[model samples]
Target: MTDHAGTAATTLGISTAGLDLEASVALAAEADAAGVHAIWTSELYSMSATVSLAAMATGTRRCRLGSSILYGVGRTPLVLAAEARSLDKLSGGRLVLGLGNGTVRMLRDWHGTDPSAPAARMEELVTVVRKLWRIHEGRVHHDGHFYHVDITPTGDVRPPLRECIPVYLAGVNPRMIEVAGRVADGLVGHPLFTLRYLDEVVRPAITKGAGRMGRRAENIRITTMVIAAVDEDEEQARRDAASQIAFYASVKTYDRALAVAGFAAEARAIREAFARGDLEAMTAAVPDRMIDAIAVAGTPRQVRDALRRYEGTVDHVILYAPTLGLAAPRADRNVRRLVAIATAPRDGAR
Candidate 1:
């Protein structure tokens, strides 16, 4: 676990959307043995991120457990703070809470909350959570824009088990990216990020925001989620990755990111196909150019080279398995290979 260039050691992580608890823990254990640095789970309507991470934490010895994203809306700051404290203690301070202001559709439909002033709300959310964790002697009091916490327990209020848990913001757009840099302990790059977008857009926004706070950009750990599909059949790997990218592109929340990457027309077409319930058309709309730009696909060596493009720019590269099309064992096999390449010694390293 050596630091590189004043940054924490570049580590490999895996993202699992699978809901099966037993199998996910098994995968985490296997990844821990394989020298993977982190295990992240998503909160995409199927499973609870906290529950999933806690399960994986108990199962693995070293790999840090994370919620690739738990919607910041629909929960109070104190509740979120308590959840973070519990998870951090459960994992012995190896918990990283990746948060996001969820999509407008999901926020309204699932959580019954209007998605207005989301950026403002998210800013307060991060602030309040941090304040709650830092309460050492007195009852925490917050009269913020989104939440008010004035808890005065009668007898005893248990202080936070830990001082703080790292909060990583998940975003791709300029405003959200800037918020991440200004407030978050880290930033989780959206899966749709291309090398060009990271350099030209994401990094610049984060750096600018950090500058406002008189903070060094290096202080924020930048972890990117790279869509991956690796197989001996190189073409098949690309196909699987394309299908996954298409699914993400079809969502309206991600349209701005695609447009920023010069894929406005393609994203429009994919969304139209999606509206008409034509998944095959959506898949076809995802061009090879876009896939190569956004994902690390193809054979093992190809994936390795693709990841190297992010070497200096990112602190961690998380393998996002958009493998709804691949079997579990096959996806695991590919990720294990990718992790091996990521953790292997670079030139002149002992």
Candidate 2:
């Protein structure tokens, strides 16, 4: 087990917004040079993560690049494996493949794919991708309902890269965590996780899943995502954070996570108020306690203190900076501030 307290080691990562691919690549290179450990690209309504990562791989020399959470059903497992292998080779084996079963809106409405039986589909996808990576020359066979692959490549389709590309599964549900424990190298906890849920629910479930494979809990790297906003004016920062929280809270997936975090009463009230167009109640429901439970908001010093509160609990804290309303210069400054605090010597070690 790696000691969480040693050196206060932390990985500084960022999820790029809807920006030009070329600009994003340059920003990634700049971030890498600024001592950022990893860079994660998302496949939202914009460019695909693979394409963005490919560009980033060419732009940066040392930083690890990966998809924050690529949908498992978004692409074929074989193709996904091939792309990951290719990116690994391109980036000199600094590629981490992060996979997850995305939201129903993305799967069904946007991508026009079936969302029924997602667990079965994800299981099959993980199996097929691993088989594709491990096997050399054979027709992979799976008797699963969602996936059945039996094709062999004529040429050299094997992943020649020797470095282990860590697969991090983004999961909040128990079954999904079990899948992660059984197959994935790491688990990315949801953004809505609270300290209580982490101790009582999430950690226990992860342990149970890992125990099934005769593996210790410490072997699995757990990365928790936290929405963060830092500014001199604390009230403005809280208001900014509330808008972002409201957006995710309205989503069913995150709403469930919030409820699990002991916010069921508040969540219900917020939902009811929102339905009735009560903006005041909606904003009021997102109190400082709720924001502090799942997010880090305040000045730079305060943000750093809040992060250190989870020092012994989580392995890595991926801070999601607010880039929605702020200008490029301001947002970049905030990002630099966060990176500085996150990578600084802990407890006045310096």
Candidate 3:
């Protein structure tokens, strides 16, 4: 049961989740200068992940560029294909295309996509995108319940920078985790997940799915997004992390994580506070134990020690700036601290 994840070198990255395009681009540049492994953006009703990544690709020179996730059904396969190809070309093939199935409300109400059998829709999205990417030779064809496509390359179109851009699917549900292991290049663990959840449930499910396909689970990268609210003021840092955790906990879709981390009561408290629209009560519901189990929030030294635990759980760890009840400037400051934390030297040179 020991993942021994720390035995291998774990890459560190940063997420631009709450920042605007200008701030994100600037942070990406800074992270690149510090030699962080990758920089990721999120598309959460504020900005297009692809659009933000395009700017980041042009701004940075070394680090890999990615989306924490674009929703699975938000865009047509053709649109996604075009955007992914464009971003990859712009980044010189340094794109990791992350996708996910949004909550049922997001799918049914926001995007008008049917929410029934979401895993199947996500699988079809992945398949169709890859098919669209491989339009160099013969006609590409796909007929699925969620998507339909038949196309041929024309006008001597230039091939995409890479035949297969690494596709990372984000999810915590067992079915989605298994499907991600079967079809995608990586699994993006949500910020709410703990190391216990990753080892106890996520990894085993991925292994089972990969085995069914005769594929090696080791090849599928296990990446996690962590809520990191770094500050010299430890209390302020913890508050930021708690606020973000409360927000994620309020979403019923992620309630399973609370049970896995042994904090279901606290989660229920947070959800109740959320339903009452009391942000402070929601944040108050996040006990220190939950914060310690799921996030890094404190001085730089404390955060460095906390991150070592995750070194054992994933191939990559993305430090996300918390946004719930946090101001833009404060969130931006958190990102700067995360960059400093990520770029700090190890205790001893190997």
Q: Tens-digit lDDT track for model 2 on 148-219?
A: 777765666554585356888888777787777777777777767787877777677678877988877666
Off by over 4 Å in 2: 1-10, 17-23, 135-138, 276-281, 324-329, 348-350
How does model 3 fare in lDDT?
0.87
Instruction: Give RMSD (Å) of candidate 3 vs. truth.
Output: 2.3
Q: What's the candidate order when arranged by decreasing TM-score?
A: 3, 1, 2
lDDT of 1: 0.80
TM-score list, all predictions:
0.92, 0.89, 0.96
lDDT of 1 by residue, 1-350 (tens): 22222244456788876536776788788878777778888887767888888898888888888888988887899889888888888888888899987777877898898788777788889999898786556677988777889975566656665666789998877888888878987888888888777778888888988898887777778888989888889998898899989988888888778887899999999999989999889888989999988998888888877776766667887888666666877766766666566556654221
lDDT of 2: 0.73
Worst 10 residues of 2 by lDDT: 1-10
lDDT per residue as tens, model 3, 1-350:
11224556677889998888999999999999888889999997778888899999999998999888887687899899889999999999999999987888988898887889998788888889888887776688888887888887677877888878899998888999998878898999999989889988899988988898898888888999999888999999999899999989999898887798898899899889988999999999999999999999899899989988876568888998888777788777888888878877755411
**Better structure of 2 and 3 per lDDT:** 3
Instruction: Give Cα distance to truth, residue 192, candidate 3, Å.
Output: 0.5
Pick by TM-score: which candidate is best? 3
Judging by lDDT against the true structure, name the best candidate: 3
